[model samples]
Target: MSADQSVAIVDDDDFFRKALERVFHSAGFRTESFAAAEAFLASYIPKDEACIILDLRMPRLGGLELLDRLKERGIDVPVIIYTGNADVPVTVQAMQAGAYAVVEKPLSSELLITRVRAAITDARARRTRRNQSASARAKLKLLTEREIEVARHLTEGLSSPEMADLLGISPRTVDAHRANLLRKLEIRSIAALARLFVLTELGDS
Candidate 1:
């Protein structure tokens, strides 16, 4: 590909897979064709610039099943479901499970290539967000239980004395936990720490 991005086609239909690969290659995309979703998952390394073209019907593991498997592994690669058996229910399920786009195949090379490029863009964006969230979580994990409680109270606009009262600790101890949590998270601003929690967690957390 011109931009060093690749598109993967996972379909058991040999002619269709090869034809799709040719179309993508002709349009300046690197293409990998697999005979089944099982094969693709076995070989695929997560790539931010890569997108998958999947078929709903295959011998071993179908597209929907493969999507579940991807999610289980925390793989955020974008997908475009291209299948001859596209129906309303299948389309709904694929989109619900985060497929970038779905296309019914009486194979349109032009449309498929367009969708592939869009999916690649989407996959890259998802990877960027996932990496950011992961970084926040890793930093948050550096705190102990007491430090985490102090951080949570800080997010709720609690002062050191108030946090001490809530945690049944001395005010000096509250201040110490706050300092340690901030240092471990490598963030100096209370608002920034609160923003990290908002982005990565919900409810009582």
Candidate 2:
């Protein structure tokens, strides 16, 4: 996990929330606590959040409702919800709403820490993928129309001569376009270029 990444604890219980903050701090994790879900959402920063430790039973905006709000805003931060009684129906509902994990209340400190570490690791992986996809899409926007066509052909495993034949251009011209696109995208190999296409979702069609 990044040094600056932090866990956001949303619980209405003052004592429980404070205890969780101390536990996370002792385990070398930074924590931000909110007395209510509304407050957490009001000041939430998507990029800084490694995970959310949420209390399911809260006043006003409950944990499941907050999950819906996060989804509406397209925030994919991992959320671990804890409730006094995690009944089957409620647990199913939370899972359907994209809660990363659901745990019962009075959770053991060791178990909480272990799950938190896993959630943070997952969040970091997700953030890295999002960054890579954004970078690939931005670099692709710098390519010329012809270069983009060549890039698509390269991803499709077409040889320079084959692409040239399909594109109604000479093999030498196709090679030039291919080289230019590779340079513009800052990718050195066809395999890497293909992976970039996958990242940008340009290969789906």
Candidate 3:
């Protein structure tokens, strides 16, 4: 983990939250602690955060509801939730709602450290993918409408003549648009163009 990246500990238990902060510090991680979910939500920005350690049972906005709120806001920070009683249904629901991992209370320090390290690694990978997708979308925006259509057809494995027939344009014009797509996207081959299209589409979900 980077020195600037801090783990966010959101739990109502002051003692436990402090203990977690200490543990993270001992493990060479910086931490930000909150006594309540609402307080954390109010001040938290998504950047420079490694992951969130959320308590499952809070007063107003519970862990699950907080997860939903994060999703609504399109925050992609990985969250690892802890609970005193982690039953099957609740664990399933938490996982479905985008909790990175669920752990029962009385967590071992070593286990916590290991899981947090893995979560941070996963969060970095997700950030990289999002950055790549954004770059792909920006590059795609430089293409004209006809060039975009040609790129789509290229991904579909359509020949220039076939795309021209379907688009009601001459094959020569289709080839021109294809060449322009390659130039504007700075790609050499049709395969790279297809990959760029897929990368741009990854952010849609």
lDDT by residue (tens digit), candidate 3, 62-160: 999999999998888889999998999999999999999999998899998888888888777777777889999999999988888889999899998
TM-score for candidate 3, residues paired by index? 0.85
Models 1 onward score TM values of 0.76, 0.81, 0.85
Write down the lDDT that model 3 would get. Answer: 0.88
**Highest-scoring model, lDDT:** 3
TM-score for candidate 2, residues paired by index: 0.81
Model 3 residue pairs with clashes: none
**Model 3 ranges off by over 4 Å:** 72-74
Lowest lDDT 10-residue stretch of candidate 2 = 196-205
Candidate 1 Cα lDDT to native = 0.84
Candidate 2 runs further than 4 Å off: 1-5, 42-49, 72-76, 202-205
Given candidate 2, what's the lDDT at residue 81? 95
Comparing 1 with 2 on lDDT, the higher-scoring candidate is 2
For residue 198, model 1's alpha carbon misses the true position, in angstroms, by 2.8
Clashing pairs in 2: none
Could you tell me how far off, in angstroms, the CA of residue 38 lies in candidate 2 after the best superposition? 2.9
Q: Over the stretch 25-82, how does candidate 2's per-residue lDDT look in tens digits?
A: 8877778999998899889887544889899989889999999999999887899998
